[model samples]
Every structure is written in C-alpha cells, then in structure tokens.
Target: MTDATLAFAHGDPHQLRGMEGVGIAHDGPAPKRIVTGYGFWIFLLSDIVMFSCFFAAYAVLLGQTAGGPSGAQLFDLRSVALETGCLLLSSFTCGLATIAAGVRNERWFQAAMAVTCVLGLVFLTLEGREFASLVARGAGPTRSAFLSAFFALVGCHGMHVSAGILWLLTMMAQVLAKGFRADIQRRLLCFALFWHALDIIWVGVFSVVYLLGSAV
Candidate 1:
C-alpha cells in the first residue's frame, strides 16, 4: 500500500512517521552488499586516519638522519617506479575482477583476480629487495630516526598489501568452491575497495616520501 494509504489504514500518521518506512517492507534484512560496504568504508576511513598519523610522524622525522644515509642515497627511483607500476596495474585488474563479479562471470573474475594477485606479489618482491639493499648498505630502520619513520610508514602499507594478496587468494578459492554466492560477491566488493584504497595511499607515499625525499 502507498504511504498515505497505509497511514490512513492504520489511522495514525504518528506511528508511520516513527516506523522505518510505511511503503516498503521492513521485515527482511538489508542487502548484504550495502551493509558490508558501509561497514568496510568505516574501516577503510579508520585505516586511512592511522596511515595519516604515520605520514605525519614521518614528515616530522624526515630530517632526522642521525648521520646515516638519506633517501637520495638509498631510494632507487627506477625500482620504486616499477613497484608503483605494478600496484597501479593490480588496481586495474582488481577493477576488472569487481566488474566480473557484478556480472557473475566466473572465468573473467578469476582471471582478473589472478593477475591482480601476481602484480601485488611482484610489488612486494621489489619492495623486499629495496629493503634488503638498504639494510645491506647500513641504512636499516634502526640506523636513524628518518629511516625508522620511513620503514614504519612504508612497511605498514606493505603489510596491508600482503593481507590483500592473501584475501584475494581466499576469494578465488571460495569462488571456485562456492560459485558466485551473494556473500562471496559482497566480499569481492570489500576487497576491491581495500585494494583501491591502497592505490590511493601509495600515490601519497610516492609523492611525499619518494619524490620529495629524493629532491629535498
């Protein structure tokens, strides 16, 4: 029944006003994707705020080298560029995966997720090499406050990426086992948002930590 009709039928607009809604059925649970996405968005915002604090700390400590090597001496821009490219490509593949999930295309979804997983692994591998080379050259996090902050800021991001890779693999396995269930699709939505958030954070990291660090 219409809102007005329902109100008249109930003989009380006050009761209708206090209710969730008069026209729509309020008995069933909310769509899982909407609820899940809202919760995940809150989580992603909290994560971003945490990262912002780390960024702020790094900014404050950027000049505190303690007689150790600096970004110019330590960062290989080419390697960082490669890492950035891999993550960007992974984001693209993740987008494809989301699209495929929405359309219930199992093959394309798995393919896209696989590519994203590979790209993420490549980014992590390059990052690991970068860290190793820095340690080998006596530029470890323990060497200086600047190095410490750098590792804290970037390492946290790396850990998030690692988690995302694991999540992606789990989703792939779930899709293979359970097919395109609604719960699984909702999970894919959350994963896509998380992966995209990493891309955004990386842009800031490259700008503030890598590009500006090397120049200034």
Candidate 2:
C-alpha cells in the first residue's frame, strides 16, 4: 500500500499533512454544550446588533422633538434607576442559578431562577408604568420623532425581558420534569448566556438612554 494510503487507513487524512499545511483539524463534532452555547452567542450578537440600530436612531432623533417635550422634561431618573437595580440584581441571581446547575443542585437552582424571574418581572412592571405615565402626559411615540425612537428602543428591550421571563419559566419546568439531563443542562447554559447578555444590554441602555437623556 502507498504511504499516504496507509496513513489515511490508520487515522484522519488531514493529520497526514504537516502542521503548516493542515487545515482545521476535525476531532469530531463539538459537544452539545459547546455547540449550543456558541450558537446562542451568535443569536445574542445579532440581537445586540438590532438594538444598536435602535440606539443610533434614538440618538439621531434625540434633538428632533418637533418642539415637543424633551427627554429632560419627561424622563424620571429615580424610576429608571429603580428599574436598573432590579435588572442588575436579576443578573446576580442568574449567576447563582448557573452555579447551582453546575453542581446539579436542583433546589438551589430552582430558587435562584425564581428570584431571577421575579426581578425581571419587577423591572418590566416599572418600565410599563413609566411608559404609561409618559403616554398620559401626551408624550406618546406618535407625538414626536424623539418619542418614537425612544419607545422603539426602550420598548423593544421591555419586550425582550418579557420573552426572557417566559423562557425562564420554561426552563424551570423542564428541569422539574427532566432533572437536568445533558440536553437540559446545555439549554440552561444557553439561558444563562442569554440572561447575562440582556443584563449587559440593559446597562448600556440605562447609561445612554436614561442617564444621558435625563441630563439632556
């Protein structure tokens, strides 16, 4: 048999080449956990890109208030600060849940996840109230370009939080029913990533949209 044929018969054909000549080495498919986490990261990055566009729009329209109420006139810093606190605390609880999941401690995992969900809900409630108050004050999205962009950016984030809460509940149910099978664990990892990403995005929103806007 030829030397190359012998090498191919013994192991991966790609390994026959020198290090510099070889392409990416395939050591079989990546584990489900890694694959799942990587795919979710891609999804999260895409979501962030979408949010970035909204942020850019908000910035451009920030001064185009059409002689309507400005952000400084409408934004309540105290309320926004409270909302930020809830979301940030939820992120901490999410980390606890991920740690518990690593140890397969079902009780602790569920409790941490529950706290995370509650905090997320609290954030949504505060945001909903803020939106309602603004609308009542004739600051609805249709009133001006500034208001429209603001609603599009902040409201989209609120919707994401709502979706995350639903996802959190689903994860809890799956754990209760399946007891953290490998697939479930992989899913939990993805959830943790998603939740943390949302928290990061919220930090940006609070800094740029709320703090800066109120100051303006």
**Most lDDT-accurate candidate:** 1
Per-residue lDDT of candidate 1, residues 59-121 (tens digit): 999989998888887888999999999999999999999898889899999999999999999
Per-residue lDDT of 1-216 in model 2, one digit per residue for the tens? 865556678875565774333453566887788888899999999999999999999898888889999999999888999999999999999999999999999999999999999999999999999999999999999999999999999999999999899999999999999897999999889888988888999999998888878777
- Model 1 lDDT, full chain set: 0.92
User: What TM-scores do the predictions have?
Assistant: 0.87, 0.87
Pairs of colliding residues, candidate 2: none
* CA shift of 74, model 1, Å: 1.1
What number of backbone clashes does candidate 1 have, counting pairs of residues 3 or more apart or in separate chains?
0
lDDT of each candidate versus the true structure = 0.92, 0.90
- Extract clashing residue pairs from model 1: none
